[model samples]
Target: MDQKLTLNGNPITLTGYNINGNNYFMLRDIGRAVGFSVAWNGSTRTVEIDTARPYEEEQPADSVAPTDGSRYVPQVGDTIRCPDGTDYTITDVSRWDKNAFVSGPLGELPQPTCDWSSFPEIELPAAEVRHFQLESGEYLFIRNLYETRRMQYTLQNLAGNHPDTSKDGKLAYGGKGSPAVSIKLSIPSEISAYSFWPWRESEIENLFHSCPPGTYYMEAWDVYKDGVFQRTEYNIRAV
Candidate 1:
């Protein structure tokens, strides 16, 4: 289904979970449309979409299709009014966030949109500390941990080889004694963007403060890519 984003002038096509049930989406897919580079600022839990595009008033739901059942599906060339009513183009179609039913071949709306039938839960890996230097002369230290679930997050202090879950479901590598996760600081020269973990509710707020902005959220997926242990990225940013 074509979705109206509140950032750019194009409609975002939908995949994976149909427009019917709840589903997950990517930050970068909508990041460029919003004029911001999605980054992972571990210090704060803030998905910063930096855009020169001034914030416009959100368009009313009035623009939605007439409730003839055709009103709730995804379609090609469909009008995707961003939250602000900006027109954006739907470029492609594929299964987003991994699963699909809602995500199918590109077809215009008036057709039934996809919906997510199932969403599983996941657990975060123990924290692994990683550090970087920012242009601000400050250090952004990230305690990177991974969770392979779909539900909520639990923060914990991973000291040994295994990190436990936090009271709120958040997790982090204990301290220096634990494994220190490293990140390649240089920006990606290709489509392979790096990811780090950050939570607004996490205890490490100072590390998230040293970012260059445009940070996004931590994404979670299956452990193996195509059936391997390829580490996936997060979908969050430092606040």
Candidate 2:
């Protein structure tokens, strides 16, 4: 038997007949659809719902063991390996929209522009500019909500990299277009502006490939933390 159900905002439309109007749902399909581990407890005539990751208590120790994504609380010095593979230390953690918001700062800063003659006297508040890193070992430049892949050269750092920010390690375009990430750039050369570029997501195969492969138009706010960045709005792309 099948039935319609909504789980975690996902519409699970099932098809099944109701017997005698007694709609005791079938456990198997529904359980798998909603990512639940289900087993019949024959002794109790009950269906045990794990409601979380399945466990193999009797399984032997092996590298093939399964591990579902676990929401771990991150501390300033806690290092976590995300699914993407880069290592980061959680510098801060906050809750926004009922989800974990994490910030990662590289333990170090981006490479300096190394040139300063065209630099301006950065007149904005210090908080107007911040840096963050993604699980791909790439960094972002942000000020409030506006951020870009490029930052004007400063004695400290230059350019927060974004998805389409560089396909050849250079910005072919700036300040407009679809992007996986966005950052506002400001610097001494009067190059201060807003830039939107894609952030690297999914499998990153070529570090020097300019833009990541398989990155679509989908944009997502992320919770990120690294030794170089801290906790802040890794948020929903505003509508």
Candidate 3:
């Protein structure tokens, strides 16, 4: 049989046997749960327990538990075991958001970087950044996307507009009979950027209030299509 156990708010699953209608867990499993050493003495024909040492599993590579009985801190290009007993390879780490995005047998999933207790707060000039902290303890940083004047002029010229006379100053352009070209905005310093979409101030505020506690990244921009106001696009991601 299998048994589920919770120790100090951490959930652990162990194999057990049913004897006389009562569940009996293996000594090794109990040792693992309580952070102690367990071993089998072949010559002595006995089970040995060492309370002074930490628990270490002599299992397969993929299912090995932490030797020191501490939480696993994942990093890029590393394979880690999840709580569901599956292996995942981390591909990227978002330092600003403190999340490690991984792909493996279970597909893509976001895992928190639990080792970090806190991240450096973003501090930028008022002309560029806005920071918020929700009641749920999530940190959010929103910044305006800025482009150099030369880059803006070059984009205007490519879109068939007069670089000197075009007064629209749109970020996104799609002229008639021409392929639509959008400016590739750079992420702000000390922040991470993920998805980009048009969003309003009210909508952003609502999302900030509703999201769960975690670090969040966002980049805001005023996007235009053919000299007309389309929307303010936001690239948002949670760490």
Candidate 4:
């Protein structure tokens, strides 16, 4: 007689001999396949099969496991992103209010009651810049000081090129055999002018590396709590 055997309504492969309409299979194979531990108990002279349980000897009894990265204590100058996708840099820590004062796009402000348990610490990348040589032999450099406090310093105006005030206007290059181009710099919201570099995304030294040898009008816009508070201009020569 041929008969099929199933467990929990699921077919289980069995290699056994049929006797009196009953089938017997290897106990260890079935136990392993079904996520059970099969062990021989010498004193009881019986096989013990139970649900698999991981050993917890390595962990402390009172320990609590974290779902993601390790626990982080907030500190001043540390940047954090809220659940709502707003990024802020901690400016002050107040234990009395149980909140942190942070700098955001709006201005210096205080965040809601801080509970960093669910929030993961993130490191915002450094600022980036792109250069577009204008048709006037001048350079309209675009800088993005992303998520950081910084300043943009204009070096020289040897080319004596005035700002291309035309909306989306094309600028021609002044150098010999140089191609004329038109491009505008999109200033990021997070960037504002400063007299000196701040804690995050400072690229003061990068200026020398990005621009080629040229004379151009350089300026700096200082970002403040309200907005762009000051502008400084200078004559610069890049060689």
Say which candidate scores most in TM-score.
3
After superposition, candidate 2 runs with Cα above 4 Å error: 1-3, 42-46, 55-239
TM-score of each: 0.20, 0.19, 0.23, 0.18
Could you give me the TM-score of model 1 versus the true structure? 0.20
List ranges where model 4 is wrong by over 4 Å. Answer: 1-12, 54-239
lDDT of each: 0.30, 0.34, 0.41, 0.31
List ranges where model 1 is wrong by over 4 Å.
Answer: 1-75, 89-91, 94-163, 166-234, 237-239
Predicted candidate 4 versus true structure: per-residue lDDT over 162-206, tens digit per residue = 232111222234446332221112223443432332222223324
Q: Is candidate 2 or candidate 3 better by TM-score?
A: 3
Name the weakest run of 10 consecutive residues (lDDT summed) in model 4. 151-160
Q: Report the lDDT of model 4 for residue 160.
A: 16
lDDT of 4: 0.31
Clashes of each: 62, 29, 2, 25
**Candidate 2: C-alpha lDDT:** 0.34
lDDT of 3 by residue, 1-239 (tens): 67888888988899989989988887877997899999765235367899999998855335222332222333444433434332333333443122233222221222232211122222322332222234643222223333122222222243323232222432222354222333333445656654433322343344434543333444444322211223334565444
- Tell me the tens digit of each residue's lDDT in model 2 across 133-177: 446654432233222111212111221233433333333233454
